[model samples]
Target chain A: MFTSIKRIVRSGFVGFWRNAFVSFSSIFVMTITLLVVGTVMLGNQLLGTTLEQIQNKVDINVYMVTTASQESVLRLKTSLEALPDVREVTYTSREDALAVFRDRHKNDELTIQALEELEENPLGASLAIRAKDTTHYESINAFLKEQQILEDPSAPVIDRVNFNDNKEAIDKLTAIIDTVERVTYIAMLVLVVASILITFNTIRLAIYTTREEISVMRLVGASNTFIRGPFMLQGVMYGLVSGVLTLLILYPVALWLGPATESFFLLNIFNYFVAEFGRLFAVIVGSGVVLGMISSMLAISRYLRV
Target chain B: MIYFDKVSKIYNGGQSTALEDITFQIAPNEFVSIVGHSGAGKTTLLKMLIAEDRPSGGDVFFESLNIHSIPKSRLPQYRRKIGTVFQDFKLLPHKTAYENIAFAMEANGRTDTEIAENVPQALELVDLADKIWNFPSELSGGEKQRVAIARAIVNQPDIIIADEPTGNLDPIATYEVVQILKKINDLGTTVIMTTHNKGVIDALERRVITMDEGRIIRDDAAGKYVL
Candidate 1:
């Protein structure tokens, strides 16, 4: 058995190297198809990273009424922090808000002059709210708005404001990313099919080239498996080599694009890409080897009953 | 020993049988010749011996193992026990003549040392030892036929089945090939050969079986070209 295996492996390698052009072309085609798939997967992951960053930064800012006491606003901030969904609540005093406004306009001469002309600080003290999940922000905002401490009975403790202004644009971005993710997955599936077809055809051609040897072997009392062994081994070798080639094409591209792609989005998802490279490599290689073996197995099994 | 017992073979959608109740038996180490016209079931009988094709009716026995009833998977082992030479002289074009003979020994699982010793002896037997490294394309018609005979007998099988062993050879080349098969037969290998040549069959003067339209018209002891 080991001798047969050795013969098959040796024959496979000899066949692979002898048909150098065909071997290179098959590997090249597999790499190109895999590259299209790997790039799209990486792109979609980056898009998810961008969307997640944007969602985390989005929040409902609650401004207290201009006449509300500092104590009332501070007490409301504490209550906001106590809520289950609330991740953070910062109490920005009126003077502290004014100071930020002045500092932001320090480089803008006209805006600084306007802020300096004000006799008293006019900015209202407010609490900034963050939630555990952005989807829960609506309920959290509603609860804060309905609070008796935030609402003034005499003057309404909080002023009117809306947090749903960016709703349409955010929804559109989410929809686009979701659609792209689905399309990318489908595109990947199609590439996989093409890769398998190409590998099958390539190995089929190899079988044709070695048909004389096959016929001779069959007649020489080599069993069916003995005659078909080298071809199957060739298929496996092609798959393994192509799989490694595909990963070779993917890893460096992932590494190079990591920072460049991060520039397009709010965060660098390349780290996630790097972390997942081992897993992705395993899957791609496993599929490549499987595709190779299956194509060989099917092709040889169909034509090589001799 | 190979025995064909009332074996009849008919192709599907055909009106006539290829072989009609052909009964024959040859003892161990016999040199036999089968002569007939084309479509005389000469090749069919040879194939049945190797279980390459089954007798449509009755059984073919190779040393008491019913070849027709043997499972397909065990057929290779049956074939390996018998050497075969075809009219085409099926030497691999890519391999040298020596490699062609060596391949037969390889298939029979002979050791490299045995192959090394036996291949040279087989090639020398056919007087093609000097042309061992030449490919089939580089060799003459007679040389290729010799290489094929060498390959057929290299594994030292119990029997050598030669279907039209000299169908393409000239008179001298045909004599040379028959002499090789005769030598192998003398070495205790049963040689079952089919041919159309009257001169070669008359010279062989061995057990002759004659067939016409699938039926063995005559079987003679120490037979000549009776047909």
Candidate 2:
């Protein structure tokens, strides 16, 4: 058994080099397939992170009336924070809001002069509310509207509750993101199918090139297992080599694009790749090997019947 | 011993019958030559012997066991008992002559030491000791055929089938190949050869089976080229 395995492995190595052109092309095609798969995965990761960042920026602001005291505002903040759907509620004092506005328009002299002309600060103290999920924002807004502080005229603690002025645009953006995610997943599925077909054809052609050799092996009293062992091993080798090649190509591209993409999307793609290196390697290499073996097995089956 | 009991082969779904009602038997260690014209089913008969093709009718028996009746899994083991040399040589282009001979032994699970010990001896038997490392592409027609013969006999099979083994060789090369086949036969290996050369057929002076249109017309002992 040990001898058989040794012969099989040696024959596989020899067969790879013997049919160098076919073997090289098989590896080349497999590498391209792996690259497509890897790129799609990375794109999905980037898209997910980008969508999360956009969702994190979204929040509802509740502006308090001028008469509302800081104690009451803090109480409101604490109550909002206690809600199950709310992630956090931050309190901004009127002075703090004014300071933020001044800092934002620091370069505009007219805005600074106008702010100074006002004898008192005009900005209202507010509670900034964030929801645990982007979909929960509507429920949290409804919960705020149902509060007694906003409805009771006697209390008159709440002034105006602003969720987002361009709610239509936000909804559209969310819809677009969902559509893109769905399309990306579909595209990945299509690519996977295409890769399998291409790899299968490539291996089939390679086996065709060795049709004569296969017949000779069969005529010489070689068993089906003996004849098949080398080809299967060759297939596995193609997958393993192509997987490593894909990673070699992917790592550099990810590294180069990391800083550049971070500046534009505010997400570090390279860090994500590095952090998930073990899983990504398994996925890429495992797919490559399995694909190679399956294609080879299917291709070689036609000739082994004799 | 090999026996063919009323064997017949029809190809293309009975559109053509390559062999019909063929019956023959050869004792162990007997050298036999099968002679026929191009479409006389010589190749078909050889294929049946190796189980490369099943007879459409009747049975081909090798030592009381029907060749076609063997299970698919046991076919390789059965084929290993018989060595075959083809007209085309059929040597693998990428393998050296040494590797080619070793390959036949390797198929039967011979050890490294066994292969190392016997490959050179097999090459020497075929007078190709010096060209052991030469690939098929790098060898001459005669040398390739010799390498092929070496590969066939390396496994020390009970019977050797030479299907027009000297078809591609010149006169001198043909003589050398015939002499090797005769020598192997003398060494207790049954050799069944098919040929068109009148000189080779006349020189053999052994049992000759002649066929015409898939039917054996004559089976003569100490036969000549009397077509």
Candidate 3:
């Protein structure tokens, strides 16, 4: 069996060289298909990173009653900060709120006069809460709603609801980005599937050209695997070439596109993570091996009845 | 020994049966010539011998083993014991006459030393030893036919099936191929051949099994193509 295996491998290689064009073309198809698959994976990562940047802008704000005690509001701010979902919280006292209002109305004398004419400070002390992730904002909202210290019975009504209130617009923006990411993922999946089908068809054609050889081999008493073994190796060679070449073809393109894309989409983000060349290359080579092996196996399986 | 036990074969999707109610037996070392007109189930008989086609009814037995009923996994081993030659030569176009012969030995699990020794001997038997390295395309029709014969005999099986072994040859080439088959048969290998070349068939005057319309029309000692 081992000796037969050697001959089959040798014969397959010899035949491949005899028909150089078809053999090389098989490799070419294998490479191109693997490239398309690997490229989709990288594209998915890019989309994921972009969506994360979009989600980072969301935050939860806690408003305090206008007459709430400064000590109670400070205590509430400290408690909110201790929650796992709360990344950070900034406490704004009533005096600081008034000062901000006065600063804004410095050039507007009528507004400043109206503000002075008011019997009390109208601005409320607020605690701005930053959640660990965008989705945690809702949980933080519920948690804040059950807290009693944020609302003062002696002051104007203050519910734990978000006060800055761009929640609807933020939610809509996140949804749009989420939809875009989903569409991109679905499109990438379709492309990978299409690549496999294309690879299968191409390998099928390669098998077709050698059908006569296969029949003659069978008649000459060659075992089914002995005849099929070489063709499977042919597929492996194609896949290996394709996979390596795809990496070669795409690596430079990725480098060229990465900075250009980063500049366009993530001007203030993406600096936190460094590029991982080895992991990316391993992925490309692995993709080529799998693609080549599977396509060849599929083609040879269809040729089995002979 | 080969026996056809009332075998009949009908293709999967066809109007009529290709072969019907055929029964015959050929003993070991017998050189039997099967003569029939085209579409007369001559090739069909050869197909059943190598287990290429199953009989739709009855059995095809080589000794005690029903040739048609061998398991799929056991087919390669069963075929290794038989040698087959085709009218078209079926030689790998890129292979030398020697490699073509060696390929057969390789298929039957012969060691390299055995193939190296026997391959030359088989080519010499076909009288093509000097042209052993020449590719099939470079050889004449006679030489290619000889290479096909050499490939068929290199493994030295119990039986050599020649389906129209000289179907593509001229009168001279046909005679040469017949001489080779006779020499192999004389060496005690069973020869089963099918042909329409009456001159060679009559010249050899071997045991003839005649068929018409998928049935054995005649079987005679030293028979001729009476059609």
- Best by DockQ, which number? 2
Instruction: Give the alpha carbon lDDT tens digit for every residue of B1-227 in model 3.
Output: 88899998888665667789999999998999999999999999899899887788889989899886788878988887788888998998867888878877877667899999999899899999899899998998888999998888777788999999898888888889999999999999999999998887799889999988889989988988799
The global Cα lDDT (0 to 1) of model 2 is: 0.88
Cα error, residue B86 of model 2, in Å, equals: 0.8
Give the Cα lDDT of each candidate.
Answer: 0.80, 0.88, 0.79
- Quality of candidate 2's docking, in CAPRI categories? medium
Model 2 spans > 4 angstroms off: A18-24, A56-171, A185-210, B64-66, B69-73, B93-95, B130-140, B221-226
- Interface RMSD, all models, one decimal each? 2.0, 1.0, 1.7
lDDT of 1 by residue, B89-208 (tens): 988887899888877766556667898899999889999879989999999888999999898878777999999989998999899999989999898999899999999988887899
In model 2, which residue pairs have backbone atoms overlapping below 3 Å? none
**What is the DockQ ranking, best to worst?**
2, 3, 1
Return the clash pairs for model 1, or none.
A65-A157, A152-A156, A152-A157
TM match of model 2 to true structure: 0.77
Expressed as tens digits, the lDDT of each residue in B145-222 for candidate 2 is: 999989899889999999999999999999999999999999999999999999998988998999988999999988
Ranking by lDDT: 2, 1, 3
Off by over 4 Å in 1: A51-171, A266-277, B5-8, B12-17, B20-23, B54-58, B68-73
Cα deviation in Å at residue A258, candidate 1?
Answer: 3.4
